[model samples]
Target: MSFILTLANLLSIAAAASGWLKLSDGPWSAREGLMAVEDASGIVMVGGRANLGLAAQHDVWRTPNGSSWERLPDAPFAGRAYHAMLSHGACIFVMGGQTVALLGDPFFNDVWRSCDGGETWDSLGHAPWQPRAGLAVATHNGRMVVAGGCFGSSIGAGRKFLNDVWATRDGASWELLTANASWSARSGPRLVDFNGRLLLLAGEVGFTADTQLGDIWESGDGATWTLLTATPAFSARSGHGVVNAGGSLLLIAGWHDAKCLHDQWLSEDGVVWRMVSNATWACTADACGRFDFWPVATSSGLLLTLGGSNAYSTFGKLWAETWALPLLGGGRPLRGGSVAMH
Candidate 1:
């Protein structure tokens, strides 16, 4: 039987003084599929789908701390969404996403790396994996590992969901660890490096509302995976944010049951989860409560999320509000601010 999460259960562990604190909306316009990672230098965000998913922005943005954000130069590669980005060693790597504009093929398998923050990038050539979007990625065992995504255009035929796994120490070449993972093929799943293992979390099979999953899986090596739970304490979801925050695993907002979710979950191991009460951001606010966004766990004991979209089909609504949740200490109440929508 599944473990049901109730209001009393959520309130029992929720700290009254702790919740999501809204920071100033950064420089970037409202967009979704934008990827961000926290490294030694700071937090760097990359390309996203803007203008109602018709325009893809190649521009990069960075913030040393969440308070201030600066727009970096446009990337060398074409702008795309549903791509994956992560920090490994001294390199920040980006790979595999689809373009919004329907011109030629929309999928991309090319890889690029930035050594000097997001100021500049060098092409690492194409990857071994097929062109895909919404793929899950994480840094594991001093290498970057990528798994599962959707391949095909927004309105094209022959669309395919994948469950393959690949890893690389350098972006130039990739090793296929597994052609098929134990989990079902899905897109927009959350992959994180936690407790010396790679944990894969809930994701969706397609655009259908009922296709979302809440299963959790883990792997020490990219080749083999073990299922931790088929049904978690949280509801089935997709496009959620999963990160390692101060040695603990955190699952943030996502889409579930045809509605945008604003709740947060905490776990020491992938098998058990706890709802972090009062830690959720405001979903009722204008252009708030997003899925398919990136969340980074900083060295400062704070979990940060910047931009994401609400719906799955069109990805029409996007958000730019920056929210920070304190994982270790007390958090302030929700604050109000104007969110600029383009």
Candidate 2:
């Protein structure tokens, strides 16, 4: 009887603690390619393509508790998608994304910062780096490191991929650490600060090429990068969500092998990875899938995923819905499918 009671208690705790709770659909319509970053205020999502390629958005949305949301004023910068946004100290910086909806040209190198949780913005002007979209940026060792992206349209007209590395202490001034990185020129890879180093992983060359890179690389300074692994256990992918959660690195859903993936991977030293859960917060069937989503780690040990698209076709649908999961130590998911509030 004692064993039964203990088992019952464990089951009850798992029921409440595990699974994903889908929150509000957010202030905007369905959209993809939005930039989201977590700061002291909460989760702030900015700029995305509305309804696939219909129009680009400059609107800003924030949620303090992951359920209730409020729309802030439109960002002072022009509407864009595939931009890089991250928090450094108390300032939130936004930079380097293409304008127009999804298929247009004219990338942006302008930098903007918000001191008040994205309520208002001030222009920091364009940086010395080339204007490009789908770039990766992360704060490392009290400095911001920027690297790799694509220039030109999504459909291959004048498209060019890049592998340069840049860094900035102040948003106004930027320095090119290396004009060419050790990694191949690619776009949309996740650049994350992991284990006191900057880790870059898994992005495609371009939409036209459809070559997804699976290798992993790391760097202490912005200038020199070392390839950690040429092939990881997880398939090569891009548009995946990556976050350093609870002292472990989590790699979430992405596109691979001409289809959207729904697996989750965790790594401690940024080399070997293990899939903790493959059946949580994503579509199990091929009829529905998601990518280009943003996953942010909260202070309370909850992993929140916001805003991604379900399909890549012209009739594809974008999501403004938010999903939350309580993670165990080392960023492991408790149960594969405990509860889904979608």
Q: Which candidate is the best by TM-score?
A: 2
In model 1, state the lDDT of residue 16: 33
Per-prediction CA RMSD (Å): 8.6, 5.0
Q: Give the TM-score of candidate 2.
A: 0.90
Q: What is the lDDT of residue 134 in candidate 1?
A: 88
Backbone clash numbers for all candidates listed:
0, 0
lDDT of 2 by residue, 62-94 (tens): 888677788999998888888999889898999
Q: Report the lDDT tens digits of candidate 1 across residue range 1-342.
A: 758954323333332333455565757888788898877778999988887777888988888867678888889899898899988898799999988654587889999999888889998889989899989998899899999999874344467899999999999878999999999998888888888989999988867678899999989998899999998999998878887765667677788877777776667787887665413564453245668777876776566787788875564778787776555532211221122111
The whole-model lDDT of each prediction reads 0.78, 0.80
Query: Each candidate's TM vs. the true structure?
Result: 0.88, 0.90
Clashing pairs in 1: none
Q: Which stretches of candidate 2 lie over 4 Å from their true place?
A: 1-18, 101-105, 208-210, 336-342
Model 2: lowest-lDDT 10 consecutive positions:
333-342
